[model samples]
Target: MATKTWKIEKDLCRCCHGEGAFNNLAEPRTFLDKVEVYSDMLRECLDIDIPPVPGELCAITYTICNACIARLRDACNFKKQVQDCEQRFMTLYYKNAIQGLKPATKVKEEIEVSIEHAQSDTDADIVLKKEDEDDDDDNHFLGGDDDDGMSDDDLPIKPPKQSVSTMKTRPKPKPKPKAPPVVKKLKPPPKPKKAEPKPAKEKKGEEKEEFTLTVGADGKERFTCKACGKSFNLKPLFTQHYRHVHLKLRPKLRSCHLCNEKVLPWLRPFHMEECHGLPAPSCGACGRKFAFPGQVARHQKFFHMGESAHSCEPCDLKFKSRSEYNHHLIKHGDVKAYKCELCDKMYKWKRGLRMHMLVHNNIRRHVCHVCQEAFFQQSSLKYHQMKKHPETV
Candidate 1:
């Protein structure tokens, strides 16, 4: 495998302009050493993979400053406080800056201390080897077995001589003084301090209100409003309170068609339904009365409803359906199409033809069977039959 050497580019930090310690632009050897130490420490402790760059030497030229690093560190530390300082630092650095590099990997700091200890032991072993080499050199300097040796019996002995009087007399040895005995003064252990009582916390200005359901003696459920804590027997009152207070809506009134009484617009149909004795909606085409607007709609749909009512622009005559209107539009061939039932004397619409036919058939009356009610128009006879003899019909 090839050897790789890491290099950091001298880029001025954008945040601090190369003034802060985080600025990698500084070329000081001490600063670089410290950075390498910290980086290696973090890599080992946090399992952080250094961002790899291609080539034998890689230069880091990123744009994060010391202030941001410190902030990110505090943010991660406050949430993940650990006993180990190196591990805590690594966790902070890796979580914010390098989490994208490798996810869900953990590291430890204890192994770094062991590595330093091993390095020191290696250095100590080298010193011991050098000392042993020096000792071996000293032994080689002494006489060895290869050197010439005299016979052991032929060796001569030196005679002992008496001390000379001319030598300078040695001074008598002085009596040695002894050290004073140490007096250890023992002190009493400190007394434990009493814990002070904490102050009570202040209450908030606004209190949260709760709404609950309560059963009454009448075996009916009552609703309570969260705002006022008041109980309402009727659900409408509860709804009104919610709309009036919470929604802040004003009550709107509308006049009822049946009784000419002012009522809530939403309740007008119900009022018409309940007030049967009051004046009801009367059909203009058939002269029939209904109790409510819904009933009138049903009556119109079942009795007189058509595809589309068409009226002639020239004669003001209305046709019940689109087919009849189209048939009657041929009189003013340029403007409409109209057909006459009695004769070829085409008019703009059927009404003009009917008016002209009235001269021929003037007796327009229908007699009812049960009441013998005779009316000039068929609609009048129908009204009489439905109102006077409704059960017989």
Candidate 2:
């Protein structure tokens, strides 16, 4: 079925109307949809484009011809005679200022920190090697190829043993009677296994959440916002309140006051160009003056060149310092990230999480020396022992 539609007005379709304003004979050809019919109407009349009315279908009935358009251009600014005259006499003089277009260029800033921490791992490696050597010595005598090359010819051979016939000759005279076979009475093969139905599995209980230790004192903590006089009851509340109130001031607040406008205090240290302004420390590596002397040296070492001194031997990744190297190791994804998915306990490894879960569940494994009572994690065990058996550390 074709979608139903109506025209704008009778006067708009004067060409199709004869007896009636909306002639049934002049009705638009039906299509599956109205979009195609509307498109045809738009192309039939070209006044730039057919204007549309809200909540109604459109019917194009007007068009601009090339001849009429040429007449309008003749009566307007675009005149061919005026253009020919200007071309023949060069009426408009060209200026040198109008430079042609060119490709654009951009400069990108890049700061890289090259850290090296591979050396600290050497001591542990040496200790592990020594431990392996000791274990090898105890388990197997791994002698050199020189000792292994010795053949049986290197050892003295022993003579063949003589038979002890004199003492047991009496028993050999008569062969002992053969013992009867202790045959097992035949039993029918077990009833062709009535497919031992698998025992239904019982799922373990769901894990619990970790115990969060709140650090507020006296069940209340006073927090004063630096920007305004807002005080919050809890630290978390204070943090949220601070962010809400002082978010705008954070960019303005990090400055140490001693340095003036020369120092932007943002990531980039802007220098105050005045000579009378206080002196700024220049970075040793890049010779860039920062607002602060210590900050300048740190930036020079860490951003300009090889700043990391410690690194992992296994993966040549570097760190700015020992602490940074330790933090970087977390990215390798091998060691324990220390997060207890079950109870929200953090550990360096899965094993640590397991141990921590046992603690939360109060799985006592260690025994006290004095009271003989067991406790969970070693720390608790030690604490119990100290309380009960003080001397048995």
Weakest 10 consecutive residues of candidate 2 by summed lDDT = 206-215
**Mind giving the per-residue lDDT tens digits that candidate 2 earns over 211-290?**
12221323233555544656555556655554445443233433323343333344322432343232344654666765
lDDT of each: 0.52, 0.47
Q: Count clashing pairs, candidate 1.
A: 7
Q: Report clash pairs, candidate 1.
A: 328-337, 328-338, 329-336, 329-337, 329-338, 330-337, 330-338
Positional deviation of residue 186's Cα in model 1 after best superposition, in angstroms: 90
| Candidate 2 global CA lDDT score | 0.47
The per-residue C-alpha lDDT of model 2 at residue 324 equals 79
The alpha-carbon deviation from the true structure for residue 146 of candidate 2, after best TM-score superposition, in angstroms, is 99
